[model samples]
Target: MGGGCCGTLVAVHLLRQHHPAHIDMIDERIPGRGLAYSTAWDDHLLNVPAVRMSVFGSEPMHFLEWLRTHGRPDASPDCFAPRKVFGSYLQDVLNDAVRAAAGTCRFRHHYSRAARLTYDGRVARIALVDGERIQADKVVLATGNPAPFSLEPAVPGCFHSPWEPGALTGFDPDADMLLVGAGLTAVDAFLALQAQGHRGVVHCVSRRGKLPHVHTLYRTLPDSFDAAGTGGARGLLRAIRLRARAAEREGYDWRAVVDSLRPVTNDIWCGLERCEQRRILRHLKTWWDIHRHRMAPEIGARVGAAVASGRLVVHAGRLMGVEPDGSRLRVGITLRSQAPLSLSVERMINCTGSDENYRRSANPLLRSLLESGRIRVGAIGRGLETDRHGALMESDGTASGWLFTLGPPRVGGLFETTAVPEIRKQAEALASYLFSIVREPEDVPVDYFLAAGI
Candidate 1:
């Protein structure tokens, strides 16, 4: 389990509901935060704004309250506060929830990493990196986003992923750095280098060379676009296409159409057949992305400034290959216009977005589950396929009752679930399910097995 947003929220909800089970949150929750909501770096800020990022629908001002209590004098209403502050808000909620509990369930935190997890009869055995294991009736896979996709092997002079601190370790500030894939993560890498006073040239490469667009705070947000009301995938596309055209005529811009479609994205996704989903993914995914997931206003400015300063270059191309060139690396890339370009750089970081291409995560756990026919991947390849109730279905068309998934792994199952709003909802639902099965002896029976001993 994590102490991040998803993990903390689940613990909070379970305590509030008085769920029966011992809860051990294994994360450096008291400090250091996490890779996402790091306060150590003041430059790091939350991607989401305060108004919309709430712990619960009923308590919309919970986070704002935390800010008032802890950071009131200095924090601005419109400020994209440092992400670490958000973590503090979450930790505060957890503390208060436990404080107010009449008969709080067994709750504690183990500040250690989960080395391995395996099923043990009706209970799951969790082994920690510090050589400890606990038996629990149910397990939640809430390990937030995993490490970023690697652009190259972990060889010297090649920075393969942004999140790994080792990549940035002892990196020469003046050496040229190449960033693979121009996306949000690439922006983060650029910002990290900027914050670190790295004055090297940052080259970002992608097929369209498209970076995330800025978020425009429109005065009047559009009403929800009900694609399901139209009935099917064709109808959904027709509705969006028509709305986009009308928005263009009204000078509303494409943003409105995309924003309006947010609430109904999952509906449209689930409504479509497998073939239709592929059609949309292949032909329309990119067009949809550049308009949808927008950047923070301040962050957007920094990215643009990097370009203007000639420190960052966005190249529209395909990476042909990269070879080690004594003390540096030569990257062969094919551009759309130019014949071809081969550049030598001290390092290359792959900010290529999520390895939703599941197989690519190269995760032993996921691969084991897949090969055992205990889990099935969805159309987008981002996560395990499950029903509305969140059953981990197998490739042989069977649902495994013992295993469940959480976080972005269910992106295909819920389109908006990657973000906080949707993730909180999922965590609540998952907690409810786990609580039911844990206390109700033999009810909701699962064919669970144990791995004997670790």
Candidate 2:
């Protein structure tokens, strides 16, 4: 029911497979360009290399080939291209798929927000905020990530989400700004400010104040680490450390060892118990994120330059509060192992990352589904509960055949579902699964099947 990257890829795969079905892509914003690629800045390069960002699983060089055809013949497979360029490529791929479908399949794009969803014994009905309804035999929730957590209550000068269109607009270029988180989103904001030629000092605060690790040009190592032998998180950590040390001793970058873990991450995550998962989240998630979600080399260089020049200040602290101080904000911060301090900045931007808790979500569709018992929260309370194949689990302890989900909605079920490589694989698998269960269009009513005792 979304048209973001995950949704777009799924639709593209379905169409390319010539599935005899009409697909509906619903989204409030532009299709294909989700929050991640919606930025207009040229400096916002993709975190992942272009070679691994293909939508098709079998065609790994699809994105690179597209780049070569589109005036970027010099672009290498490992190049971190601008995100907007990728967005255009995705849009072009979708357009080409639509043309290839011809009269065999139909696609409808609804540029509207889905307010609520309800499923009867038959088809599911999606009610839009504009009072329109779409009935479908099967529905897939690919709603992507939620808005960043509102750490502090909304005030006049406090911005909760940095990605909100024009959120940084109209700010004085020379005025000091404070960012609440020091992650990728925070880096994006800092780059945006730099792009605008902002000369004022910028402060970024987080609990650890650790930016993402920089990506290096290195060959990936062979997958030899046995995840099954590693019992839990501690064992896995020990195994990884040993492998990294061995790699260092052999004159290979440690990142190669870490990159090799990508194939077995889900297996390792699944092996851990709920308590272990919680422990990892509480203690090691931040460290793991900084390493796993590294920044582009160019981006890292820019950030380093900014830091070296004293233009960007990063603080390891907890944001206690923020009060509006006429024409500015008084930010209360408590640094690690230090007393609280106050800083006045002309603007405060919240880049605290997505709020994974469903109960705290402001989306009406999620809330409605939760209240109706159509969907239940995940075991870790990070996202909706889904099975191994990304089918939604219901409140009555059964997986729904009519509803499926991918991307961030499956984060609890699959620890690494947010990235392009992971989401593209999921989309391909989902499309294959859907095609396997295909039935005649007239036989889509579940109630009829139940009545006949089929």
Candidate 3:
């Protein structure tokens, strides 16, 4: 039930597919409100367009159908709705999946941080922060994105982490807000502050001052992917580059480009050797993400309004340290100078997305897996390596039969794996892969009202 997008998507399909596996969802926060959706704040909005938030590609109108039935029939498909609403939508999908399952599955819920995971020859064990252990036939690492890495500074007042909710408790919006890294997280913090009635001067510091490009008008691309023939890093790149250039010449928009790339993303990712993947991350990742995963025009307009109205400001630099002055916080940032400037604020929130630096992670299970050479970081310094079947490869290059990673954690294998459309495919693929190992019962399609026995 954790709010992680990929985890919830997979769980929904797992139940819907009539797999006889008992399910257990473990996380530290609210089950349906993973980090993105957990925020009750009305200002933090989804970046994806509502039309694309369907549970699966097969059900293109799932979210649209949901909206029409739930009194939002005229809701603009291109608008970004509140994150809480998407959270609610996720819960609804889960409920529907449970109903569709017709008693084929059962689930256990745990509301605590997963401290570690240990595996013997046969079963995998999960260690929870609340001092509980869960053993299962299969363990999936759905640990979504983590907060961005903090800068090392000599001073004490530099607050580097964002996940600490207390950091924003009783925050004064009138104070100066010095933000580090001007990306999606920075935008989230900015909007959340406004929703909380914060009226402070916001200073967003980052290496580049460019913001994410908003999704333009949608233009469907030709479904021209050849997943079977693509192999080797260079081979994949050559194929994609030819198509991308063709896409541009054909006047394709962001949506079209992403749509065209969808079928071949995994194959392309796998074809790259460790070193090539790293090069892509160092150079192409930022550009790729901002262009590929675009923001809704409606939300983009709001962010633009914030910057235009003199309520927000952006700078290019790194945070050196942070200092606390009573209830107010003072942040030290090195901007355009050899020395650091002290900027004070009433609150600071980390919007830096997901933990990419693996060595600093304290999760016991991940640490154990890494040490045992069961999972190794790809050259990109972010994401775990996986094979075509979504099987995780440990550092020693052995694929675990009972362990798997479902979503963004497999970014090294599939670049665009976090969204619902992509995730639903993965969930179904994982199910099909697991079922294929031995003879399996026929699966009745979980469609039609009668199929759900409602």
- How does each model score on TM-score? 0.88, 0.96, 0.82
Report the lDDT tens digits of candidate 1 across residue range 1-454. Answer: 5677777777888888874445667764562255566545666667666766678867767666668778576554455766777877777888887776637566778787676667645566677778876666666656666556666445666665776666654678898888888877788778878787889899989888899888766633458776657744466668888988987888777777787777778877887777777777776676677777777789888888989999999999988888889999889999978769998888888887676766665665566667766677875676778766566777887665656666677875666667777777777887787677564644423432122221
- Candidate 3 per-residue lDDT, tens place, 153-181, comes to 42333445544555444565577776676
- Sorted on TM-score, best first, the list reads 2, 1, 3
RMSD of each: 3.8, 3.3, 6.2
Q: Would you list the C-alpha lDDT of every candidate in the order shown?
A: 0.72, 0.86, 0.68
Error of 2 at 294 (Å): 1.0
Query: Model 2 over residues 210-274: C-alpha lDDT tens digits?
Result: 98999999967766457777776788788889989989888889888878888878878887899
Prediction 1 TM-score vs. true:
0.88
lDDT of 1 at 293: 70
Per TM-score, the best of the predicted structures is 2
Please estimate how well model 2 matches the true structure, expressed as its whole-model Cα lDDT. 0.86
